[model samples]
Target: MKSYEEINEKIRAGRAVVVTAEEVIAIAKDIGVKEAARKIDVVTTGTFGIMCSSGAFLNFWHTKPKMKMQRVWLDDVPAYGGIAAVDCYLGATELPSYDPCNSHYPGSFRHGGGHVIEDLIAGKEIKLRAEAYGTDCYPLRSYEQNITLKDVREAFIFSPRNCYQNYNVATNCGAETVYTYMGVLKPHMGNIHYSSAGQLSPLLNDPYYRSIGIGTHIFLGGGEGFVAWPGTQHAPFDPRNERGIPLGGAGTLAVIGDMKQMDARFIRGVSLTGYGVSLMVGIGIPIPILDEDMLYYTTVEDADIQAPLCDYGKEGYPTGEPCVIGSLNYAELKSGEVDFQGKKIRTAPLSSYTKAVEIAETLKQWIVSGRFQLGQPSQLLPGGGSPDRKED
Candidate 1:
């Protein structure tokens, strides 16, 4: 018997390449019952529809010079305890016609059935006997009738039903392929939702449904919901709406909510990228935007105005004696007071509650000076803040 490392080395070195089920069983037989069962973790089949082909083949290359072997695993044989008996078909025709927009109702219904089965296997509550149909139904009049809708439907019902009882059966069967229909269907029954009419309908609007879809397709577990946000295009609620004030304007204030509610775990004063902000934004949940001071306007500083004059000739200025004047002189000339504008333009202390206000004023100045340009918001000001608060 080969050791685990020896088998793994064979696999890695390309000496033992089990690309097909036949190869897998062959290796299993060669390695003996105990060793074969231990070494071979999982054997899966995938099916694809061919447009102009009659036979499909699996191919791979072993780059390792020391190992060169190819193996195939076919389900057509019965000696393998008919393990391939679980294979089912999946096609559009096999599934009931439901509006894709409202398809969630049916999808959820089917998924809920699968979920129940999972819960039972996990020793949870035994809710109900729910199952999903897995039969590949193609367009009836399409060129390929060899794998007809009827064939898929019969394959799903009889094949899976024969292998296991109480499990949902798929009515859409295709060729044995990776991730068999039964393998995919079992987990989904728990997710299906039953309607008042006793018909299966998916829980369409549930955020969990979207999360599951995203999690499955992208292989992102619960925490990976961040990537789902960009795909869903869900935008965070604007605090300005709730406060009845525009951001960067007078009377605007920041709103701070419990960061914990946002699922933001604090780590050494640095919020991890995927935790708090991602969760809040991904699910379209409203979060507190520090709105204590979001907007303010202030007189342009002498440093700001003079800095530009030094870079560009004062040709546009109306006969200015000196465009690039010092701060003290500019303040005195503009305000007729020594410390009026100059003192007001200085950066405020960090302890000040008006930091947001101060920043808004600076941002405005920057925009006016053409030093920066702002991108368009995902949504506009009218939809900017929460609408619960009355306009001030």
Candidate 2:
């Protein structure tokens, strides 16, 4: 009986090929049935599925003896829309209107719809109820070549934290709103800075032309465009103090408004920078953002002031450290005094990509070890897919 390593070497050397379930059992007999069974299960069911779903595969030359391989047969497996079953498991309470023209399900907001959020919120413990429709489950497609039995071994590998670090950065920094300003290409350049005269001048005729010119000194002598609280203040003359300006002419501009209302506008101008980076580095696994406890705040005018004032620094400012304003805050001017409300005004929380990467790596390890599952189904439908229907 050939050892597992020996069989693997033969496959790599193109001396042997993956055949079928029976052939796999034969190989396992050589390496001990228990070892063979474990390898077969991992390869055929675990690894193959992942590769197929993610569209990533290991080359044959890189095959290891214990590694499982998949073979494609000309035969097709039973394939179903799996839509109804998926919807049921996902808690899709409503079905998307089927678009015959597109052959796509335009899902709805019902519990079993195809929305990613619904599934995420549902968590992994939810048992999906399968709904049967016909004798044919679903049409399965076959691969063009047979897989090596060894190549089918599925082992959970932990991805590094860097795999998900980019997502963390983008999400924390308002991924949808940041504009991408690559070099001379300002795709969504806003109403080219109008002067007091409201005249649209050529780039050369612009009032701050020199300010926008090469080496013209960003942020001016004083960090005029920069805005931050006293605790978060930038150096008066530091070039890097140019807050809200793009970095190296390849960053985004910060816009202040209600996030929900501005989400679309922000997404329009910005694209995720770390997406390409992650894919290139082979850390393209998707990582989910967990919902942590939320922090909330309440605002009141200074009790002592005769006129209600919202000014943070005025007598109305909270007694101790002033409450910080954040992306979620509300501000109003009452009686000509600025009143601010939200999480106390402070420096935006610095989300460390390093920490995010660590968590992601841990998740990957869990997945590889069969301790975790990826792409959990949800009960919610895709956004704007369908109206929430109450079933009696």
lDDT (Cα, tens digit) per residue for candidate 1, span 1-392: 33324433443444432222223335544665455444442221111110010011111121112111111122110111112222322211111223132233212212221222122222333211111222232111111111211122121110110000001112111222212211121121111110010000010011112111211111000111111112211222222222221111111111111111222111011111111100101011101111211100011122211111110121311244433222222222223223322332221110111221222233233323433222212322221233442333
RMSD of 1: 31.4
Position 87, candidate 2: lDDT: 16
Q: What is the lDDT of candidate 2?
A: 0.19
Each prediction's TM-score versus the true structure: 0.14, 0.17
lDDT of each: 0.19, 0.19
Looking at model 2, which ten-residue stretch has the lowest summed lDDT? 291-300
Q: Positional deviation of 14 in candidate 2, in angstroms?
A: 37
